[model samples]
Target: MIGKLSMGAGAVGAISYCYYDKKATDGNGEKAVRGELLYSNEVFITKLPNTHLHLQYLAAQYHQVAQLNTKTEKFIWHQTFNFPPGENVSNETMVKIACDFAREFGFEHNQYLVFRHRDKPHEHFHIIANRINANGQNTATDRKNYERIQLFCREMENKYGLQVTKSKQKSYAQSSSVQADKLRKLIDKHLPTCQTLSELSIALKKQDVIMYLGRGISFTDRNSGVTFKGSALSRHYSRSQIESRLGKSLVLQAPNSKQIAISDQSGSKNLNTVIKSKFPSQKESLPVSKMISEHNNATETRKDLAKINESLRSVKNRKVKRRIN
Candidate 1:
């Protein structure tokens, strides 16, 4: 149960804008203006036309209108669900559930849609609205909106006997750096006697490293850092060879008190010897994926944060420039 809120227009704005833009141009363009476009895949439409106008009409009918001085910009909200395995709910059913949840939360006029992405394994949906009441005042879409959504999701799970994931207390991406450091230490210890890629992998596996293979192999330490393929071991070694050496074939012994003491001494002396053996200019250092991965992540994070900060400053400057103009 991970939730993230993003403004309609910002770094994450393109996807939201695309959803709305597709709806406005759906086959029945004439009907698009009637209601808010909830979800679309650029080729299909989901909401009925004149829905927004109708919702405004309904708010007026119910005498629950809020006053506003200006027209509120159209904003779209998205909620992605990671449904538990073995749940037989279809994409259509999930959408209906979300819509029902919205209604129970007093959003009777809201239009919603569940969209299935064939490319991904999970089912997710989107909800879009004009945050204006019948009186043309902007309605708040903040903490209360999130709380209501969460409550409804929980209710749906309880009523349908669906499995709901516990709330994620931390982010994986943010703490990846810390994990990288630990992997760096592990790789440094094993790199000396790890003559073959297979041996290196075996040592890593003993440390509980999870290897992900794709374009390249990524050895991830669940607790801290990850090493990329071709970083610690050579690409010359085939995956099969590496797997045979480090895979289920090997029976790894858990380090006992004596084994721990021996391992520490062996690892330390080996590392020291290797470091000391290297000449200042002719050092033949092998690539350690763990260290490279951590460094790259740290660099990328710094760059992204800088870009975000710059964007914020530019926005503020534009306001000042407008005043001067």
Candidate 2:
């Protein structure tokens, strides 16, 4: 899992983006509000529907509290917890984790909301809380925030049996040069036998190298647990570059998770359940999908190569001396 924290002045915009029912289109012509409220603290009322006004009202109240601590210009605390791919955590568990972090980090009394966003390949939840609580006090402290979070996330992972992200930090005591040498050796040994990018990942794991595919490919030495980018080894070792070498075609598939704006709204219950419960198989894998294509240039190069290879094969009757750059 990954933990991130940011602070801002606007609350309504943040709240609406996470919990709004009506669809709001973004620059990409996609829904800006692509998630549902897993749990909300003070935004709900018995009879009144959660409208734009209600969102504004909560923001206004939080801003009112922000006035008490004029020193804290950024008064809205926005926290997001990201679970790794293939870790099927439930909605209740995610909410519990966020609430646990809040109580431990000294924001228990603050008004907050948790939203589960399934618009991406991996599962993640966001927590928007008032930095200035109802009691006229600053709840969030920036001092040593990162250090505390590192430990807290580890504790939570251990407690809940979630994927431990702190392994890299813990096992990263070895020199980077040593780690890189090990990674390079492994890649050289295994690259020839693998075909698909996913195949290469599975092959590396047998040798104790944990491959993480994202915008690019990275490998973690299971012994040292130090992760190094593929580009660091060589530019050709990148995700798309490797795919090009392997002659794998790019498959642009949309996210299988349907966006839900309201928690009460009904959709395919099985799909939603699978999104939360199902995990990926050991051999088959997907890159960390915060964004689909990180190495677009390299990916484009691969497509061009594929087309060129096909064209060359078609003109095999004549000797065509084609030099590829």
Candidate 3:
């Protein structure tokens, strides 16, 4: 199940239109507000108010109930249904399931306004809830709230026999790297034909390839290997896209003199010196000679040490003989 939390503020007008039913007459003989037509795109399943304004109001009330004055009160945590089309669960059932989950997660005080938005291809619901609990206590909405919501979603899916999409847990960095790899391949394929960064930008735009520009050239897709002149790409693409694609560019100014060093005798000698210093001697026996020299030196040192020790022992033996005489 995919779940996202959104805070809705300044939507009082939208909320107020949900509860006004035009067909129903008011007590004073006034025609009831035609809220149903206004909210044709919205399906309210629970006891919560139908208007977006009322939903926001309830959310604010709950925000107070949860004592979350410092935190934003107008919020919606959206969850997608795990059930397949064959299960025949109506959009209303999904909305109710979501509302029940929200209530379980400390949204009990204010009524939850659940609306199934028909704007998208898939059936998704919008849940507006007050952030406060009953008895006017401030509710906590943090990472833990998200985890509990996920747990509840899992349980509900099992109870209703819904197909659940397993979420692959990944750090932001890992996911970003994966995305970068994908973009890099796209960039590499288009880089050669892109004579200028603008041309590259146009090519990428056609492919829906987004990139960020930085000081150093960076490619979003490894395969595309797109090169961006920081200044050129910055004007065409968004800063975020540029930064996201090409990291910061490294600017190096050309030397003023631009003196071309000719490979004359001096240059040749210098080159030879560098090569000789870096490479082994052409003579293969050079290493063997050095090894032999080292071994001889070591043998001589051992012999000298042995001779010294023998001399010391001889002197001690003579002293013992002299003392005995």
Candidate 4:
């Protein structure tokens, strides 16, 4: 299990996202969806079925508690308990783990929520809490909080007999330049698989990278929230260049089939030349589509030859007329 912690100023916005934020998607770029709410603590009122009305109620409830603390700028305590994939954890256990953290973090009395999110591959839950207790005591301080969470996670793993995650020192050590380079390479690796700009964007979403295309291109690292201009990373990754790379103009068909498929794998080869190269044997073995293409070429060649013969006859007639006159 991994415990990541952060502090925010707004309680309503933080809690609302835990209730309704869509991130997961069906690979075909279909409608994005989010997970459901699992557990709630200190219910002041019943949950409403309508998403908007319930979120409004939650906003009011969190702010009512937040008004107790006017001095603190950041009163939201948000953390996520991330379980490794393939770990079968029950909801009761999940709530118990969240409550344990609440006790440790001193938010047991504050308005907090524990929500299970299925959008991610791993089993994880978000805990959103108002750091201001009922008595208006500011019990939230994020100073070296990550270290505290790591220690707490290790203790939980031992108690629950869950798979232990080896702690690493300063795991988020990659600089922006380093991250941009990594993204640059990833885009290059996936460009061949993409046939259009939209296709490339969809492909990169699975990796948590966003590709923006327009007159100029840019890329965003969803994890780090850093966006890089195409030219900033490398000149080769510019909008027009990447667009040209993804825009496959050649329509390839099978030996005798007319099912057109867009591709750029042939690289600078003309369509007819590619067809002939693939089918070097007798014409009888050629596909219907290729035969039709060859027939058109033959017709054009014959027309050109006939035009040349007409020009030669006209030239001879003009010379004979000049001699007769």
lDDT of 4 at 79: 88
Quote model 2's TM-score. 0.47
Report how far residue 221 has shifted in candidate 3, in Å.
14
- Candidate scoring better on TM-score of 3 and 4: 4
Ranking of all candidate structures by their lDDT, best first: 4, 2, 3, 1
Q: Name the regions of candidate 4 deviating beyond 4 angstroms.
A: 23-33, 49-53, 168-325
Candidate 2 residue-wise lDDT, 136-173, digit = tens: 78877766554477777888898999987642232222
CA lDDT of each prediction against the hidden true structure: 0.46, 0.69, 0.48, 0.73
lDDT for each residue of candidate 3 in 1-325, tens digit (9 for 90 to 100): 4455545543443344334443566676754543332112122333334322334444344344445444554443333333333344566567567656655766554445555544334545555555444544445364444346557767777776666745321111222344545555666576545434565667877776544333433333323333333233333234434433331222123344332222323335222112112233459668889999999999999999999999999999999999999
Kindly give the number of clashing pairs for every candidate: 14, 0, 51, 3
The positional error of residue 17 in candidate 3, measured at the CA in angstroms, is 10
Q: Is candidate 2 or candidate 4 better by lDDT?
A: 4
Per residue, candidate 1 scores C-alpha lDDT tens digits across 64-117 of 222232333333344555564445566556566656654564343532333333
Between candidates 1 and 2, name the one with more favorable TM-score. Answer: 2
Which prediction has more favorable lDDT, 1 or 4?
A: 4
Candidate 1 Cα lDDT to native: 0.46
TM-score of each: 0.33, 0.47, 0.35, 0.48
Task: Give the RMSD in angstroms, all C-alphas superposed, for model 3.
Answer: 17.4
With a 3 Å backbone cut-off (N, CA, C), the pairs that clash in candidate 4 are: 255-287, 256-287, 256-288
